[model samples]
Target: MAPGARRLATEVVLPVPESGDPVVVELGAGAGVFTGLIQELLGGRGHHLAVEADPRLASSLAARHPRARILNDDASALPQLLAEYGLGAADVVISGLPWAGPDRATQRTTLDCVRRVLAPQGAFTAFGYAHATRLTSARRFRRMLGSSFEEVIPGRTVWGSMPPAFVYHARRPRPRKSAETIDLLAAQLASRAAAATDMRF
Candidate 1:
């Protein structure tokens, strides 16, 4: 496992509450490192979902974290998955996605997904390397997150892990749009694009 991945797993385990039926979701769970830690944190008591894009990792997570429902899909599909499980919202969402910087598209999609599945005042936590935050990519990520989430706060650094790491903690706000709203917006955009193309012809 990579040093950054280890640090992120540790970060996820630190802030979880000891009791309560907290619904947890983990994105980019590569190699089951963070997935296993999340399972341990939950103690097989609550609903846990692990989303991994890699089939092999998803399979490994399914075998290792039997308590967790492994979803072999993209992070963007989170909202739909939560609905399928009848989960109105998640108490926490942990992410360890590898990106060069804050991806606006991903930020928007993920924030939308989080809002749909996160309960009011629920937290969304993700980590990136400390060195990456110093770069321009990190700045963009922060800006994107600021626009999407109600409160974006930086968490403590994981010093024991390699290269060091910092976690971003954001709380979901109330009165947010549903996943259906986002789907409608996407359809509207597609319709507009198709209309423009027809006009050109």
Candidate 2:
């Protein structure tokens, strides 16, 4: 988390729709940085699941926010974890995970899990260093967001932190048939019409 990054995150630009009861999940919530901010914004209206992979940090997070359910698990197990709580998907998933630190495969797997666990209209928000966009992994991660979400929007760059960082917010991809499948169906329909015409002739 950056200096003003937490404030930037809580701002409306991130676009977390406040339904009557919205379910929010925070990944890599080490030391309760974003977790505190998220709790304040949630205003005790809904469930907040704070997931920290480290046992020590998870314990501390649980202590700090007793209302939040702290999960000592990996990001890849999000689907199973949500099932335990009788949730099909989360309304919002905020990630504090270090994208640049993980290997490319690990990053991809974690992102895939996030996408799988997000509701149809849910949003996913994460941050990356302002200067890191030139890096291969950062660029690759941005591309991954583009493919996964219907809309990928970047927020203001917070330059007050040590290195400065910017927020990347993504919405869930629309559920629909793929372009290839639709094209194949069209071709099949055309072939059937042609065969019918030949038979009539």
Q: Compared with the true structure, what per-residue lDDT tens digits does model 1 show for residues 3-87? A: 6657667766565668988888888888877777777777867888889999997897788777889999998899889989998
Largest TM-score belongs to which candidate?
A: 2
Q: After superposition, which runs of candidate 1 have C-alpha atoms over 4 Å from their true positions? A: 1-8, 99-102, 174-201
**lDDT scores of the candidates, listed in order:** 0.74, 0.78
Off by over 4 Å in 2: 1-5, 8-13, 174-201
Q: On residues 101-168, what C-alpha lDDT tens digit does candidate 2 reach at each position?
A: 77767876787788888898999998888898877678667766766677889887877755778889
**Counted clashes in each candidate structure:** 1, 0
* TM-scores of all candidate predictions against the true structure: 0.78, 0.81
Error of 1 at 87 (Å): 1.1
